[model samples]
Target: MTRSINEVRVVGLGKVGELVALLLSDSGFTVTAYDARTRSDLPFACKELDVRDGAALRSALTGADAVVSCLPYHLNLGVAEAAHDLGVHYFDLTEDVPTTNRVLELAGSGEARNVYAPQCGLAPGLIGIVGSWLAKQFDEIRSIELKVGALPRHPAGLLGYAFNWSAEGVVNEYLNDCEVLRSGRRQMVPAMTEQERVVIGGIELEASLTSGGLGTMCETYEGRVQRLDYKTMRYPGHFELMRFFFDELGLRDRRELAGEILVQAKPPVDDDVVYLHAAVEGHADATGERAYRKQYVRAYQPLTINGRHWRAISWTTAASAAAVVELVADGRLPQTGFIKQEDISFVDLLSTKNGALFGDLGKV
Candidate 1:
């Protein structure tokens, strides 16, 4: 018999981590929060323990059914290693491709007794699920294009954006190579190179290549789809400005300094919006000879949860990880091994309490 997950340990107390802990607790899970610094203001049980300390991390993860790492992308491997040693399931919101590969290697080594799920965030997480759902609707897939962005509701400054999430993450995405499937072949493209314009909800924005947003969808649909790609959406003129910093100023080589500049110059905004669009074009199953295109567009804003306001990025990213964790706990997902975002159905994700924020599943 497969045991159900009841006790969860969430590592990190940042914006998204705090919400993950609260949401899991509200969903009837025993939640233990851990971080490097003391956080007495959190409403749940939290401990001050550095994840770098293997003994401390192992101790904190004691008896945990699952451990969710909300730490930065680079810091997730340690927690994942500890979780594997403790025979506990592990999940993280990392967008780093190399880090995900390392996690996959760990999951495939036969040493892990539980599942290892990585890149379980907004773009790579929910976006991949939505894209896979759309692709399945067709008899033969021809093209799949995914676009997602988190932008300030009220734009300011020359960049026309603000930091709604991690500055380092944003910079990293802009600097890394993006994977896409073209003509049924996997290809790697330079980030921020393919700039296109799109309009959603009457608002104009630009979409460009971004890294780690596609998750494992490229490999999943490599031979099945003729054209498949994922891009990040931003306000008009944003991509050009980023190109200046990354190319003209040569900030791509100095990513740390670039991150610092972005963090210092771009103030974090509470009022923000998350935009998601997944367009699939192919022959419908009902009419295999006819060509059809299906597109899903959604815009999410900040909401108050449990009497406290949270940013759109915070809740979206946190909700994605939380929903997946819940699904694993309920036996809706595989009990062991590495899991891909496409492995879970969009319907199952929408059925969760946290995933309901994506809106009604009937429309899909």
Candidate 2:
């Protein structure tokens, strides 16, 4: 049985971790904020510890009931391993499929005392839950499309893009092979292919196949849907710029260097928008004449947390991660196993303190 109030420790004090700690604290959990960097504004017990240091990580999680990771994808495995050994629940915001698979393997060790959940952020996180919610409404689901983006409200650069989140995660997705299910068959699609333009809120935006956005949806919907795909939304010219860099310039082979270049050139922005779009199409009636469609559109602006206002991208990502941890602490989730963001029920998610962030965003 899950306890009433969990003592939560957050690793990473970046944009995502800051909001995660804030939201968890606000939700009545005993929150502790841990980071190598110093942030005077954050609430709860604040400590300086590097999660990459396995010894330090275990020490930091000593008495904590749960650990929520807001670090980049590369740093997740160590923390997950430590969580598994320490018998504490683990959660993270990662879109890396391989990293997620590793976490799942670790979670399945059967010796863990608590749950291990990854991909608890925007696309893989919220989109998975939204897709699962729609799947339940249809009997013969045929197709599912998910489009999500963290974009700048105001344009400044040639790409019209902003670095509101992790540069490493973004670069990895751009370079890696994307997974998609076509006609009930799983295959690899080159990243940055299948470019298209979409208008959201009367604003014209571009979208295309990006790696890792689908999370475990491809496997979850493999046999159920004839077609399943996921894409990342960006400004009109972003895809063109990326194609030139990854394909023409051959930066795909040098992802680290490419990420360094982008970070040095294009930094994060404060005024940004987080947009999530999901649609599931299938038959509703037994006659096979009725078509059913369910869509979820959630948008978030810059918000304040722990008395520190952060970008919308940070808040959304961090808040989403925090919500997963809150659920596990409340015993709403599995205690010892691999947990996907889709495993979360939409109804249960939106009702929580941090989950309420999606309440104001109307249904699409």
In terms of lDDT, the best-performing candidate is: 1
All models, RMSD in angstroms: 1.9, 2.0
Worst 10 residues of 1 by lDDT: 355-364
lDDT of 2 by residue, 48-138 (tens): 8877788988998888878888777888888888888888888888898888999988877766677888889887898888888877878
Cα error, residue 242 of model 2, in Å, equals 1.0
- TM-scores for all predictions: 0.97, 0.94
> Relative to the true structure, how large is the alpha-carbon lDDT of every model?
0.89, 0.81
* Candidate 1 runs further than 4 Å off: 1-3, 287-289, 360-364
Candidate 2 error regions (>4 Å): 1-5, 38-40, 286-288, 362-364
TM-score of candidate 2 to 2 decimals: 0.94
